[model samples]
Target: MTPQFGHFRAESGAGPLRAPMARWMIALVVLLFFSAPALARTAPDSFAELAERLLPSVVNISTTQTAEGQSGIEVPVVPPGSPFEDFFKEFFERNQPRQRQRRATSLGSGFVIDARGYVITNNHVIQDADEISVILQDESRIEAKVIGRDPKTDIAVLKVEPSDKLKPVRFGDSDVARVGDWVVAIGNPFGFGGSVTAGIISARGRDINAGPYDDFLQTDAAINRGNSGGPIFNLQGEVIGIATAIFSPSGGSIGIGFAIPANSARPVIEQLIKHGAVRRGWLGVRIQSVTDEIADTLGLKGVSGALVASVIDNGPAKKADIRAGDVILEFDGKPIDQMRKLPRIVAETEVGKAVDVKVWRGNKPVTVKVTVAALEETEEVAAATTRAPNETPKASIPGVGLAVAALNDRLRSDYGLDEDAKGLVVTGIDAGGPAAEQGIKPGDLIVEVSQEPVTTPDQMAAKVTAARESGKKSILLLIEGDAGLRFVALRLAAN
Candidate 1:
C-alpha cells in the first residue's frame, strides 16, 4: 500500500492528519522488525575518558647504545709538502676519532605492571642498550635496569625507582577478548609519547613466524616503530595485549599489528620477576601437525592433536613410555586442539609435576603419567632407531612409488649414517611418482610405516598392502632426513 505521510505534519488540519500519522507510525514499526538487533553495538561516543586515565600508566622507553667504531679507511701518505698533504692529513685525523666511537639511541613503549617500579616492554627495545631511560607522562625521566628477558616471545621486564606513587595497570583476560571487540592501544608511536589509538581486535591465534610460540593477537591499531612493547587495552581500561610488531610495507601503520596476549605474557612476566631467568617446562618430543590423510591412515576419529615424530631419549616422554608415533591428544587435562597448543601448555606446566598425557596409539587411546622437567637452553632430540633388518628387497615394489633397501655397512659409510642407524633407506624413487612428489630423496630413511617400526622391505610392503586393503587409499611414513624426522603421507600408486 502507498502511504502518504505528507499530511502527518499538517497541524492546521489536525482532523485530516490523524489517520496518516497513525499509518506512518505503523510503517516505522514494521521497518524496525527487519532491521539490526535492538542491542546492536556501536562505536563509543568518545574514548577520552578511558585514555585520560590510562595515559599515566603507559610509559615511553629510550635506550642508548655505543656502537663499535668502523674500520678507518687507509689514508694514503701523500708526498711531504704536496698541496693535498694537509687536506688528507686533516680529513684522516677528523674521521678517525669519530669512527672509533659512536652512540645510537632507540625509542619504544612500555607500561607499569607493578607500582613498586616494575615495567614491561619488548626485549628488542632494550636488548643491547647500555643505558635505559623510562619517561613518564609528567616529563620525569628515570633510569631503568633490566630484570629479565625471554627472546622466544620477545618480552622483557625493567625496574625503576620512582620518586612518588606510580600509576599501574592490571591485566585483563585476553582469552575472552574476541575478534570484533573494541580495543585501545596506548603507545609512543614514532616517539610521540602518550599517544592513543582505537581499533578492534582484527584476529587472534595468529602465527606470523615471529617465534616458536607465536600465538599473537592481531589488531588494526596504529602500531609503528615506537609502539613496540605498548599495551593493547580493552574498553574496560585493562591490559589485554602487549604490542610487539607490525605488518607494514612502507614502515607505517597499514592497520596490521601484532601483540602478545596478556594470558600468555602474564605467566612469563611473573616467572621473570621471581627468577632472573625463565624456567619453562619441557616435554621431550619432536611433534608435527596431524594431517587429514595421516588421521585417516591411522584410523583416528578426526585430524587433531600433535603427531609425535620422534621421542627424545632419557627425557620426560621417554620416561613415561610415550612412543614415537603416538598422537598427543591431551596434556595436563587440557585438550590440544592444535599442534602448536602443546608447547605453550607444556611450558606453563610446573616443573616436576606429574601430569596425565593422553595419546592415540595402536588405533586406540592410551594415557600415561609424565613428570615435567626444566627445559635446558641447549636441549636436542636424540637420534631415532629402527629394528634390525630381516631381508633385503629383490626389486622395487610396483604398487608403491619408492624402493627401499636394507641398511648395509657400505651404504652407511657412503651416506655418513651413524653406527646404530637401522632402517629401510630409500634407494630409488620413480620420476613423477608419489614419493618423488613428496620430496623424498635417496638417502632418506624410512623409520616407521603408519605407527609401527619398519625393519625390512617386506615389512614396509606389508604395511602398505594392509593400508590399501583397509581402503585408506594412502599410507603414512616416518622419514628421517638431514633436517630431522617427519611424517609423510603418500597416495597408493604405481612406481
Candidate 2:
C-alpha cells in the first residue's frame, strides 16, 4: 500500500513520499536563512559601546537639608476628671523636648555639560539644600555650588572645581529625533549610581502638566526616582533630553518617563549661565483653545489657533491693537498650532524684538507688528473697575432665547451684583434654547457680543441679529460670572 501526500506532509512508513517531503524541508530552511539577517536588524546588537562612552559624563547628585522637627503633638481636649487626660498629658511632656534639628538628604543624577565643571540637573533636585555634592564615576566626591536655577523649566546649572578635567556631553537636535529611535539613559536610580537603560523614543510633544512649557519627550526607558536631571542620549551618544519625571503608580519604573527636550532646555540653560535667570518675552494676552463650536461661530474653516480672551491693558498686544475675540493664527512667522504653543514661543522670543503676529479678524487674516516686551515678575491682577451708568432700556432677545435686563441700580440690587458690574444681565433662559444649552445661566452678564460692548439688552439682541444676518451660524459672547470672564458660542435659532 502507498501512502498519500497531504499539504506539505506525508504519512509515516511511506517511502514514496520521502523525496517530496525532503524538498519542502529544504525550501523552508532556505527561506529562514535569507530572512534572519533582515529580522535581526530591527534592534541593536549591543548597547555596551554606547553606554561605556557616555557613563563617564553622568554624575550622581546628593543634597542635604537641615529640617526642623516638631516639638510634640497637641493634647486633645478631655472632659473634667476624665481618666485618660492624665495619661495624655504625661505622654506629651515626655516627647516635648526630644524634638531637635535633623539633616535630610536626597539623591539624584546629572551630567556634565562643559569641561570647566558646569553640570546640568533638575532644579527640584538641589532645591533648598544646605549642602550639595556630586559623585563622579571614579567615586570621587566634589562639592558643587548652584550656578542658576529655573523653576519654570525645572532646570538647574551647577559649578564644581574638580581635581581633574571632566568629561562632557554635547547636545543633539531633539527636533530631528523621531519616534522609535533608539535611546539610552544613564543615571543613579534609587541612589544606585552608574546604571544604564536602553529604550526607544515612545512619543514626543507630550504635555504632562508639569509646567507651562511642557513639551516633553516620553520614553519607555526604565527611569526611576534618582534619574531626575540625567541625560537621555541618542544612538550617537549625544544628549537629546534631560530626564525630569516619570509616571508610575508603584513609585518604581513602570517604563513611562518624561524628559525635557534639548532644544527647549538649551536656551534656558544658556540664559541661566549668562544672566543667572531666564528672561522670557511677554505677549500680554489671555488666550484659550479654539474649539469646534468657536470655529463654527467665527466662520473659521477648522479648529486651530489660539482665541484671544482678553488683552492686557498697555501690554505689547494691547499696544499693537490686538483685541479680544481675535484668533491668533501665527506669531513670528510660526503657526500657532495650539493654544499652549503660543506661550512657549513667546517666552523663547527675544524681548524688545518686533515680530509680526497674524490674527484672524472679521473672517480674514490681519497682520500686526508688535514689539515684544519683557515679562514682569508680578502677574496681572484683574481689578474690578466701575462702569459709567447707561440709561439704555431693556429688551427681550427671543432669537437666542434670552431675557435680559439693563445693568441699572434696581437690577443690580435684585441680582446681588456688585455696583461696579456692567453689561446686560441675563434674567431668564428657555430650557431648549442654544444659550441655555451652552451653560449660559440666568445670572451671567453679557459684556460683549461679537467683541462689541453691549450695555443694554437691545444692543445684545441687535448684535445677535446682525451676526445671523451676516450668515454666521452662531455668535460669540463674552460672559462675566462670579468666577471670571469666559467666551461662549451660542447657536442662532433658525428663522
Candidate 3:
C-alpha cells in the first residue's frame, strides 16, 4: 500500500509543494515547544498592587533631639605679643559663644498594630525624641504619644487619635514560620514612602548583640536606615517580625536584615498595650555557665547547666533553697539550654506561679519549687550570708606564696566592697610567681578555687595543691574586685 501511494502521489505536481509545506510544519512545532515556557517564565508582574494594598498600614516616624553645648567655654590664654595671638584670636572669636543648641533628627518606619490608634515600633526609633510624628501613605500627619517603652527588648508602643479607624496589621506566630518562606518588607527606606521588597526568611534566632532579649528573624528583604521600625510581613500578609537592623559595610542594606521575632514581641507588646509597661518575672540569682572544668570539679561527667553564683537573700531562689554552686538544669519543666536562656525563661514565667526547678547539687539532681517574683526596677535586698561574722581567722599558708587576709570591717571599707564580700584579699604578689604572672595583683580578692570557697591564703594554697595532685595543670579562681566578681583560669606551676 505504501509503494502504490508513493508512485501515485509523485505523478502529480502537488507533491513538490507538499514537501516544502512539511518542512515549514516541522519548524513551527520545534519553535512552539521551546518558546512557550520561556515566554511564560519571563513575563513582568509589577509589585504595585501589593504596595497599594499594604501602604495604608505602613508609616514613617520622625524624631527630634535637642543637643546642648558644654558650659564654661574659655578662650585660650595667649600672650599679646606672641605671633600666633592674632591667628588664635581670629579663629576663636568667630565661635566664641558659651553655649550652642544642636538639633538631631532621625527617620524610621513603623506600622499600625491596632485600629484604636495603637501602634508598635522599635524603642530606639523614638527613644529620646522630644517630639514624635507619624506620616501615613496618604500624606496625613499625626502626632504620636508614647504609651510605653521597653529598653531591654527594644520595643515601644504609641497611640494616635485619628478621625477614622486606621488599617492595622495582625501578628503571625513567628515560631511557625519556616525558613525559606516568602516574606515581604514594607518600609520607608531612605525616606521613600512605602517601599516593598520580597525575599525569603534567611534564618532565625540571630543574636547580633542588639539587645538582651535578642531573638531576631534574619531575612534577605531590603531593610535599610528608615526600615528600622517597619513591619516584616509573611506571604499571608501577617506581621511576623519588626525590621530593626541590617549588616552592611557602607551603612546600608545588603540583603542581610534582622527583625525582632513576633513571638518574643507579642507578650511585651500586649503588656505594654494593657499596662503601659512590661512587667517581667525575676529570679534573683546571678548565674554562670558550668564549664568542663567546673563539671569535673563538681564530680560531673559533662558541662550542661547554669551555675548559680549567688542567690539574692529573701528573693524567690533564695527562699527556695537554690544555693550557690548549684547547677540549674531545668526550670519550670523547660530545659535550660544555656545560662543566657535561663534569664529569658525566668523573666517570661508568670509571677507568683510555683515552678519546679531541677538543680544538680553534690552529684544529685533535686527538684525544688520556686514561686516566681515580680521583677521590679529597684530590687534592693539583703545579701546572702556567705560566712559567719567575726569568725576566727585561719592562719595563712606559706608554701603556695599567696598573701591573704580575713574579711574584716576595716578591710571591707578599705576595699570599697559590700559587707557580704566573704573572701580573703590578696595583699601581696610575688615578683615572678605564677599567681603574679597570671595577673593576680595585690588588693584583689580570691573568692573560690576549684569550686571551693577560700577565706584565707591557706585555703587557696591547699586547693591549688590538691588540684595539682589530681594532675590538673590549671586552676579556676573566682576573682572579685571593687566592681564585682569573675571567673579566671590560671596556669599552675609545679613545685
Candidate 4:
C-alpha cells in the first residue's frame, strides 16, 4: 500500500507525526518571542543621543605658561662616513640659543558645573599657566579665571563670563556605580575638542598612589593626552567621575584609565568654590594598615581597619582616650574596610563635629566620642628636652623580655643613636618574648613608660612592675627608633 510522503502514522494508531512537529514549532516560536527583548538589551543601539546631550557642557581648556629655561638641541645621527655631519653640528651649535624665555601651551578638558560659568577640571591641567581659555562646543573661546585649585585632589574650579547661560552637567552618585556599568567619557583628546569614548567601569577604589586620597574609578575608555580633567558620565548622562589619569606606558591610552569619583570630588569642588580652599578634618594620629600578624597579636578575627601606631599629644584622639595600638574599625558609622579608607573618611568629615569612633582595644570593641579638628597644613614637631644623666646601674625585667641600660655615651655610640638622646637603652631582648613580637629591637630606646620619663634601666623596670601591680594587662612604652618616635603596647607577661 502507498503512504502519503508528508505524513507518518504512529504504531497502533497512537498519534500522527504532524501533531508532535506542530507542538515543537510552537515552543520554539514562544522562546524567540520572549528572548528578543533580552538580546536587544545587551547594548544600546547608539550613544549618539547621550553624546549629543553631553557635548554642550564639555569644554576644551587651553593654557599658556611663560617658561624660562635653556632649550637643548639634539643633533641628528648620520653615517660615520658622511662628510656633512661635522659641518651640520657646528652650524646648529653656533645658531642654537643657550637660554630663552617662551610661552608653553598645554591643552586639557573640563565641564561646566553651573549656569553662571563655573567649570571644573583637574588642577594639574592649569597649574602654572599664566593664562587660561575655555573653548566651547560652538568654538567660542572665553578666558577663565581660576576660582580655586586643590593640589591634593588635583581639582580646580574656574569661572568664565559667557554671553548667555552655559550648559551645565550634574553629578551622579558614583558609589552605586558597579564594575560592569557602562560609562561615557567626553573630553578633548590630543587637543581635539568634543571627543567622546565609551567603556565599562573596569574596577573601583583603585589606588594609583597619585595622592593621599587615591580612590579612583578605573575604566577601559580610550583616555589619552588632553583628556585629563574631563567628565565621565553614566548611562543617564550624569557625571559620575572626572578623568584624571591613565595607566599607559606609551603615553597613550591602553584601555586602562582612571577617574576620580564624583562623590569624592563633589565636596572638594564645593569647598573650592565657596572658600577657595578645602578644610579637612583631622584625627591627629599616625596609622598603619592592620597586617595579619598585627591582627593575630591583637586577637582580631580579621585583618581589617587601621592600626594606631602613635597618637598626637593633646589631639582629638588623645583627648578622647584613644590610645596607641588601638585598631580603628569604624569612623562616623562607616566601616573602615581598609587602612587607606580611614584617612579619606576623616578628612572629609566636618571639623569640630563629634563622631563616635569604634576601635578594637584589648581584644574587645570600644566606642569613643572624638571631636574632629581642622587639619593643619604644617605638621607638629616634637620638642627636644634635656634630661640629667642617671648613674643607675643596668637592670633586667625578666617577664618584659628586655635588658636595659643607661643612655650613656658608650651605648649611644654602639647603637648609633643621637648624641643628645636621653632614654633607657635596650641592650638585649628575648627573641620569643612579647617585646620582640611587638617589633622591639635590641637598640630601641625606651623614652617613656606609662607616660613617665625613663632615663635609666631602673626607672623603666620600676614602671613596668608598677603597671603589672596595678592590674594593667599591657604597658605603653614610648620608643624612639631609627625612623622616629613611636608608641608600642606590649602585653605584660606573668611573673
**Top-TM-score candidate index:** 1
Any runs in candidate 3 off by more than 4 Å, and if so which?
A: 1-53, 64-104, 178-181, 379-421, 427-441, 468-477, 487-495
Q: Which wins on TM-score, candidate 1 or candidate 4? A: 1
Residue lDDT tens for model 3, 92-141? 78867768788899998889988999888899999999999988888888
For model 2 the local lDDT of residue 337 reads 83
TM-score: the better of candidates 2 and 3? 2
- In order, the Cα lDDT scores of the candidates are 0.89, 0.89, 0.80, 0.87
**Candidate 1: tens digits of C-alpha lDDT, residues 161-206:** 9999999999999999989889999999888999999999999999
Identify the runs in model 2 with alpha carbons over 4 angstroms from their true place.
1-42, 72-98, 380-396, 399-401, 413-420, 429-433, 466-471, 493-495
Number of the candidate with higher lDDT, 2 or 3: 2
In candidate 2, position 98 carries an lDDT of 64
In model 4, where do residues sit more than 4 Å from their true spots?
A: 1-41, 69-99, 379-406, 413-442, 446-479, 485-495
**TM-score computed on alpha carbons, candidate 4:** 0.74
Candidates 2 and 4, the one with greater TM-score: 2
RMSD after CA superposition, every candidate: 8.2, 10.1, 12.3, 11.1
TM-score of 3: 0.73
lDDT of 4 by residue, 344-403 (tens): 999999999999999999789999999999999885575443322433444788578877
Worst 10 residues of 1 by lDDT: 385-394
